[model samples]
Target: MQKLKIAIITLITLLSAKTSLAQQYMKFSWKDLNIDYSAFAYLIDSENVIVRINSTQSGVLKLAEAAGKLRVHPGYSSKARVLEIGIGEVIYSKDNKMSGSFPAFRLFQENYDPVTNKVSGRSYVAQATKIAQKGYLSSRPDVKVQVYNKLSDVQQNVNAAAYFLKEEAYYKQFAKPSSPATNNNTSTNNNSGNKPAASQAATPVTVHLVLVGDTKDASIGESVKSDLIKMRSLFQNTMSVNKNIKFNIKEISGDQLISTNVENTVKSLTVGSNDAIILYYSGHGSNPKGSNSDFPTAAMIKSSYKLENMGNLVSNRNPRLAIVIGDLCNSVPRTRTALPDQPLMRSAPAQHDPARVAQLLIKAKGKIVSTSSSYDEYSYSLGNNGAFTNSFVDALTSAINSHSNMSATWDAVLKQSYKEAYNKTRDIVNKTGTKGQNGFYRGSVAYN
Candidate 1:
């Protein structure tokens, strides 16, 4: 309370002292400053823009600014609600509404109004946080009503004409002509979580485990694919213990896989109903059109094999599920150069979509594609195995061991795997300050 009062005094002083709109900052408290939630832009420089606003809990996060919508990172914040509007850090009024360096957050509120009433707004905030976290709150029945409520707050805020004006000049710094690539929370594998029920008749399930990588051109497979390969045995062994699942895993590698045979291998697969095909590619990839390009265009490719349509090919067989994950670069820059260590994975192969190439390998509705890094970022490796692939295996294995009905709980496997991979990789990146590889699930985000 003391701090809030002090801030109040400071803001009043600052407001009175400064007559220019270009002031560095205006410190204020939540108590008296009833300014409804508005868009804010922090200009780090002419090129780098940081978009932010306060939420109920996660504070201000680094928002991906584009169009008129702030995308992703809504679940992450620094725990501070202050906007620190200065040094190009801005929020402005335009035409009578909020428009500026940042877009008004897609504040979907239900069950209450936030701007008019503080208590109801708090409830809305709690629900928004829950939605941002998704399935993690499945067990929290108490909050379900608010969380599941429709996206009405945004409309409500607009209808009441309670919206703030947008500062167009500052907003132009971050807004893009094209819509930005959406945040991907897609997870590839969920085969580990569910076990077919005992009462269910024994049905042979066909699963194809395709390991795509380069072992010859500085074989990343030695480090990236080995543990994943070893874990395959554990996966099969665990699956085999069940008399119901008759599974077969075929790993294709060497110079042959690196050649034209890559496409042939995927195109030749045979899958039956209730079948699943898992494609794990540990190599380099790129987003040719740029990171802002749609996900299908960011194909992660290599010299050894044609993996672009792997997911689609598998899905064509009408398998029950398709899992495609790429441990490689999914660059966002217009001009993406391949890492110096890689030869075949060119520097942003033009018109290539690594997600489709690497992740959407099958293009089936039942598929999940997760990648290690977004465009313009590099992936990390410890010894030989990739940080993403290693964490992915550990998460899935743990989920599998804890559950038995794999058929009924594939999504559970995906959730845990996605969470583990993201957290493990995020930890390393945060600690090392590494600039590439923050893995994300392309389907629905399973991580809390």
Candidate 2:
């Protein structure tokens, strides 16, 4: 009888432990509930639903309804408490196209407001494995509320879903058409290459871009290449919109990444007062024992070069705007292994306003310096891309697509990018038990 009593007590303890774990996993702050749902077509048919949930308990249902993709049915218990919310069906577009889908989800509340008829808590998701299996819809209704298991699993599902949704939206909106050769030749000859005399006479503004990457390292070579490609694409798309502005890009990698070659390339560049110069470096870096500056020293295969010196080289040219970026470690020199590749989502292409692009890129005047990691921190990379570089590209793309041109300043974009990189690094550390990296930036390019 004693043994039986002990066994029952043990089972009850285990169940209690599990319930506590689930409760902890479901706790989310108000900021966590801010999800962008403008990509869907349901809110008002023609108008996009860009909803920001102000109240924790009352907004979950509104979000589901506005998304137009989730069919949620709420159930109440004897005391008028929500027992579970059933996801009845996954609704697609009218043409039966797979526009979007919802995973099995639930909202937890701590207190109920009698006057407002609202609860006070946050929405949460179940285990990633279960959510993945039942996230999409079938022809039949899968009406069930899943229970939360682990916080890590919940985060994994949320990040994965958000990444894929952004990618899908980007591809649908901005992907280039199939035929590039014919269209490129026509556009080049008629639109850009052969411009009218009056159009060419405008104060010619050229953006000089210098990209240096350490492609010799086995672990981060691919990442350097990926950053270079994304950087080129961003500048090409944004700068090409203005006929008065021209782009000049220089790439130095492999054997050409030596200090001498890098210095000579910077010195040889001819920049005008109306022009902008940007230099981006990606590779291994280190902070020496007694260095004065917090920025990392770029470790090339043959020699090391201080980023401050490089920034000075660019700033001395006296361009309208000078920006320098180093996507590497700012800690002691050490070897690193590549992490598993995460899903990469590019910014959606939008019709950019010429004035906005010019306001941030051309009209802005000053020097900006940014680094992937702060002093004593180790920067991280996933497969073929640096985390900070990817975040900067994402932020820059968003800035270009901003509703107001005046609001899209270089300082705002860089600051947001650094914050995002820090958050991403934190998430990676949480999952892999690795050291965290914090990005840093100083100076700004202000609007004229």
Candidate 3:
């Protein structure tokens, strides 16, 4: 009996150790997007290790030391075709050769009508430069034509063709890799403060800021242009003043949706573990999932359920300094639901949460997250800019004035922005005193 108990204890210990090692996060980037190289690393509960790719030339798939080898998705391709710029007129004659002053139109897939088998939609026409008075065989139409037209249109067409091809190339490059195995057994930090080793020198850290503005739901007056401008200025000031810190800044506007495109960009930025990444998002918040009566405060997904794509960008242990600041209105009453026009006045607040964003913050290895409002709060704004964004900028500027880090700046900005916005629109919130405190949500978490 004593021997059996000892054996069972040993077995349990091994199983527990294996389970703890299995859960991990893997991060990828643009280079890894095309070829699965050493773009990703694994962060186990205890130790994190770099995922080394063995080959880049021979096989389509390669395995990592931690995450097994993944096959690259087969990229898409299409036949290339020449496009004609302009054509004046086309005339068919009996002879094999035909002539015209204006050049013939070049046919492409878009211009050609498959149903009609003719270039019906195109402006230019195809004309044979060489013409014979007596026409040759009509059955064999395999003939060459010389095209001519305006120089400007030709230049434009060439550019268009190039752009289209480039877009297709970029899309194919973004295909996702095969999911890594989640085995605990297979799954996978250090700090030195004062004294440096004889061979070691502290390398100056480079902080990369990728600011994305999500204003797709912006009304005519609530423009986010000024907020973006202010954000840029803050980044510039930080980089210019701090001799030890270098910054690479990226600004994305509403033109870039918070979808796969945004995800790809984030992946590209956060791949290097040495980087300090600051991601700021300004936009309208919505829950794609329907409202819940029991827990009306549950957060909603703005779009699809396959939001893992967005989550994957920050889910891995990639960056050294990661700060995510979001300026979003979480408590906007659903349009279908009968709620007050003034979000502050809604009697029965629909229970919606920004849990997705919260979960993203937790998944990040080293992170500081600050939200404009609380999970259940209705963030307000006025004069064509969002309330939260304006406050966020104000807070950031204040923090800078105090010579504080990014987190301090956000805290100051958030407080100042809200103060300014509330002063401007006190009447709205004053009327519904009941939901006053309940309508605001702010998240401040520090993980270094």
- lDDT against the true structure, per candidate, is 0.38, 0.55, 0.34
Q: What RMSD does each model have against the real structure?
A: 23.1, 19.8, 25.1
List model 3 lDDT by residue over 71-118, tens digit each: 111121022112222112111112312232122222122233323323
Task: Tell me the deviation in Å of residue 69 in model 3.
Answer: 48
* Predicted candidate 1 versus true structure: per-residue lDDT over 1-448, tens digit per residue: 1111111000101121223222222211222233223232221121112323322212222121121112111234322121122111122222222222222222222233112211121211122324347663232222111111122332222211111112122222223333554758544443433523431234555567776654443535445444344345434533344434555665555554553454566667777776667777766555655334323232233442223455566566676677776666554322122222211110110111112111112222366666666544556554434656656654444433323233223355555554554544454432235544555555532210
Q: Please provide TM-scores, in order, for all candidate models, with all chains considered together.
A: 0.42, 0.55, 0.39
Error of 1 at 217 (Å): 3.2
Top TM-score hit: 2
In candidate 1, which residue ranges exceed 4 Å CA deviation?
1-200, 219-221, 289-308, 332-365, 403-415, 422-436, 444-448
1-448 per-residue lDDT for model 2 (tens digits)? 1111000000001112112211221213221223212111111111111111111122222111111111112232112212222221111122323222233232323243334433443333232224335533121121222232543443443332321222233222223333557554464533353433433434878889998998667778756766675576568644455556788988888778888888888889988878888999988898866889899999876798888888898899999899898898887785433577555433233445555566677678999888888887778776546888878876776675635342668777777778877776675442224556777777766676
- In model 2, the clashing pairs are 223-384
The weakest ten consecutive residues by lDDT in model 3 span 4-13
**Poorly placed runs, candidate 2 (over 4 Å):** 1-201, 345-348, 402-406, 428-435
